[model samples]
Target: MSPEPQATLELQRTLVLVLDLCGTFAFAVSGATAAVRRHLDIFGVLVVSFAASTFGGISRDVLIGATPPAAIEDWRYLAVAIAAGVVTFFWSPLVERLRNPVRLLDAVGLAFFAVAGTEKALAFGLSPLMAALMGMLTGIGGGMARDVLLADVPVVLRADLYAVAALVGAGIVVGGHLLGLPVVATAVAGGLACFALRLLALRRGWRLPVAGGAPPPDGDA
Candidate 1:
């Protein structure tokens, strides 16, 4: 490969790594907050944080045949997750005081994870459609795991436009790649789109249509 192409690839990889780590931290904080709300001990809080931060990435890597997933192989991912968990555990009152902090952090994580996953899937030679789906999975899988551990419904299954936001973001990344756009530009655009859509959905009470008349009182199926 030429020097310029090699440099671009390196930059792309750097961007992906940054996105993944940022998403991990955001999700970890959200998970820790949930654990604190549930009155879990420090160890339980760390467990939940690690699960929420790394489950999606691990699942994506496994499906793509990237054995020894980055989360497991990379010490940075674990360190970031544990740091976020400890911070949240020690500062529960401040974290909880933020208006709907969990959802806010989740949106940040969803944006980053969706874009990063799509990029990795595409690099691994997956079809654009499959890459997009994988990206959505990468965005929502951690939240599902976190909720399961907490004995609650997954936010992706019920939250306003949760999975839809991820899909849209992933689609944007794939679309940009197919169009020969710049990788960094596409990633930022996709992440911002996903984050904005999620927040907008939450603010405007947007939701998919419900079955059997209105949605249940608690927004479950």
Candidate 2:
């Protein structure tokens, strides 16, 4: 490859890595917060944090045939999750003081993971449709795992615009790729789109219509 192309590829990889790590940390914190809320012990908090941070990425990699996922191969992923977990555990009161800190952190993680997962799926030669779905899965998988571990329904299934926001963000990234747009710009735009949608849904109480026109259950996330 030419120097320019190589440099661009390197930069894209770095961007993806940063996004993945950011998502990991954010989700880890959210998971730890939830654990603390449930009165889990420190070890339980760390376990939940690790599961919530890495499970989605691990699933994505396995589906794409990337054996030994980056989360497993890289020590940084583990360190980041542990650090976030410990911080949240020790500072639960501070985290709790933030308005809906779990949801806020979850939104951040969803955005970052959606973009990063879509990019990785595309790089792995998946079709745009499948890549977008992979991105959505990446965004929601951790939350699902966290909720399940806590014995609650997953927020994505019940929350306002959770999965839809992820899909929209993933679609933006895929659209940009198909249109030959810049990778970094598309990533930022997609992440912002997802995060904004999530926050808007939370504030406006927007959600899909429920079966039998019944009221949707209130989301706990």
Top candidate (lDDT): 1
- Worst ten in a row by lDDT for model 1: 1-10
lDDT of each: 0.91, 0.90
Off by over 4 Å in 1: 1-4, 100-102, 219-221
User: What TM-score number comes out for model 1?
Assistant: 0.94
Model 1, 1-221: lDDT tens digits are: 12337777788788889999999999999889889999999999999999999999999999999989999999999999999999999989988887487678779999999999999998888999999999999999888999999999886786579999999999999999888888889999999999999999999999897677787687644
Instruction: Compose the digit string of candidate 2's lDDT tens values, residues 1-221.
Output: 12327777788789889999999999999889889999999999999999899888889999999989999999999999999999999989988887486678779999999999999998888999999999998888888899999999886786589999999999999998888888899999999999999999999999987666665456322
Task: Indicate the worst ten consecutive residues by lDDT in candidate 2.
Answer: 212-221
Q: What C-alpha RMSD separates each model from the true structure?
A: 2.3, 3.0
Q: What is the lDDT of residue 212 in candidate 1?
A: 79
Q: How many angstroms is residue 43 displaced in model 1 relative to the true structure, after the best TM-score fit?
A: 0.6
